[model samples]
Target: MLSIMFYIAITAEAMTAALAAGRRNMDWFGVCLIACVTALGGGTTRDMFLAHYPLYWVANPYVLLLVCGAALLTVAIARLVDRLRWPFLLLDALGLVVFTIVGCNIGMEAGVHPIIVIVAGMVTGIVGGILRDVLCNDIPLVFQGELYATVSIVTGVVYYLGLLAGLPADIVVLIALAVGFPLRVAALVFKWEMPRFVFDREMRK
Candidate 1:
């Protein structure tokens, strides 16, 4: 439910990014296709592995329409897009946060252990971007040592902990988002990154 909307939002962001990069034209079909695949790819992977049956959009066609309509709406905003990069990032973060929460939920429902729930949440967050980058032929932002996937993993940990504390589902998701999204934005703003390997010496030396 909410997870699908998260995908729609992510799809919208990535579709517009693709359009801006000229990888995809701002046509109806292109918009819809990119939106659906970009948004749903990660969650779909998780669901298939967990055997969630019939998949999400197949179980509810409205979600498909939601993604399509979102892409169409994004076209109108194209004029002001140059002024909206932060908005795009914010939307992308929200979508990631939402999907992370949903993935955590699925993990619990599937009877996964706590550590595995964290893994599931991070996978749900990252794999979509991986698919999006691969399809768009862009360098994956996730692997740039940036704080992207790290934030997702942190949020997933929070979700599992909150779940163990017997928090309400809505509260658990909200906590995860509240913690996760801003950290992601801050990481982007400050260019926060994890240290890369130096091989203990310069390779060129």
Candidate 2:
């Protein structure tokens, strides 16, 4: 079940990234590149941090094909996708939580410290979007006071604690999703954001 959800989340991420590439007027190759990065970059980053051998996509190279296929499909139906913005947003939120859970699982398997587990989950959840935005020449959404990384951290904490309490892994995953997914959706609906620290003073040359 987790494997299925992971695939779906990556597909959704890829499609949305393809849309971003389209907006930038990128060619097919560029669209595929962006889609791959947005869908797989987070997990790749997490693997590198943990020094996990044979990265997820590296071990399962077909995921790259899946991402690129989803991206090209999105290009074919770009108009329809553009109109279903809310659905995509919700899928993206699901992806965030799922990625966090997966990352936490990897961190636990690595026998890392608890703090590192949460940080690993967060990096897995947000880094892909950060890479996407950077490649697209825009400010990363995670840095824009959105509730993205916070949601990942919360989900990771809940998941880790649930497992620590001896709950079944599947149940822990569902519980984390229940708590984190709603929090993110609520943040989006309520426009909840972190308070920004703006320093508008100009430096003296």
Candidate 3:
């Protein structure tokens, strides 16, 4: 189940990256590069933090191939993506749920503290988008104007609680997805966002 969800998550992330590349009018190579970064960056960050050797994609070379193929396919269908905006949003939400669950599971299995486990989940869910945005010279969505990272933290907490309650692994994953996906989609659809804190420079005096 984790394997399947991981594949789906990477594919969805690649497609989202592809769309971002399209928006920038990037060529095929740029598209592939962005897609790879967006698809793998989060998991890579998580693995490094955990001191897990031979990163996920490096261990499973096929996963890299899969992401590359998905990116190329997305480029082929680039013209229709704008028209399918809602589906793209839904896919991105699904990716967030899957990655958060996977990351939390890894942290828990590694015997990390609960807070660290949840933070791992958030890093897994948001770092990819942050890397993509940075590469594109845009502010990462997790940092502003959205409830993006908040949803990841929510998913992580839900998953951690499920573990504390001794729920089965599959049930825990289902609960996280059920709760997180809708919350993320709602935020996207309703333009929900965390209130930004603005600092007044004159106050420094």
Candidate 4:
């Protein structure tokens, strides 16, 4: 899917930036490892789930080359990162939207209903990040950011609705990306959070 490809591209770029941010003393292998995990990990999980064989990167090994180039390109542009923070986040947001769309598409192809399509979409986006956080030994934002799964869920719903409406694929991708990306960004900027206490803690009589 075009959406998934774009998501991979965006993730590669963001991973390159992050590695550049942290790779001052890291060896070349370390750089490549980070780039690979960040870019390919999520899509790998998605494909594995759908039993989509050969995997996207394996079919097009140039994707690995593309990721490598991105990481190397970062070394030359490290100074620009200060101005590129917002861009990185936006790219990441795009990846999230696009990957979810691809996952839902796969679910539809598998004859899954709308609700499972939504869950599949969210799983595609979240699982890799969960793995990444575990590797990095940090708190996964999916657990901490109240908006995390909420954004994925909302975007999944949007993708399903767009499909049912028979919107052109391009339009659906654009609108979903536009809607989800900003909502996530706004959550970050405003520190907006879903209420955790909405569920009553009191034991019922």
Top-scoring candidate (TM-score): 2
- Candidate 3: global Cα-lDDT? 0.89
Q: Write the per-residue lDDT of candidate 1 for residues 39-121, one digit (tens) a residue.
A: 67777888888887778778887777766666676676666664677777788887777778778878888897887777777
Displacement of the residue 9 alpha carbon in candidate 1, Å: 3.2
Compared with the true structure, what per-residue lDDT tens digits does model 2 show for residues 128-183?
A: 99999999999998899998999999999999999999999999999999999999
1-205: candidate 3 lDDT, tens digit per residue: 7678778879888987998998899999999899999999998899899887688888988888889899999888877866787887888898898898888877887788899899889989999999999999999888887898999999999999997999998898889888999999999888999999989999999
Between prediction 2 and prediction 4, the one with superior TM-score is: 2
**Worst ten-residue run, lDDT, model 4?**
12-21
After superposition, candidate 3 runs with Cα above 4 Å error: 200-205
RMSD versus native structure for model 3: 1.8
Overall lDDT per candidate, in order of appearance:
0.74, 0.95, 0.89, 0.72
| Model 3 worst lDDT window (10 residues) | 78-87
Alpha-carbon deviation at 40 in model 4, angstroms: 1.6
- Cα miss at 150, model 1 (Å)? 0.6
Query: Candidate 4 on 1-205: residue-level lDDT in tens?
Result: 5746674655555464345435445666666666666667776876787777788789989878877777767666666754677777766776777777777887787677778788778877767667655555666777874587788889989878987899987788778877888898888789898765445558654
Error of model 4, residue 203, in angstroms? 18
TM-score of each candidate structure, all chains considered together: 0.84, 0.97, 0.93, 0.80
Q: What is the lDDT of residue 63 in candidate 2?
A: 93
Q: List the residue pairs that clash in candidate 2.
A: none
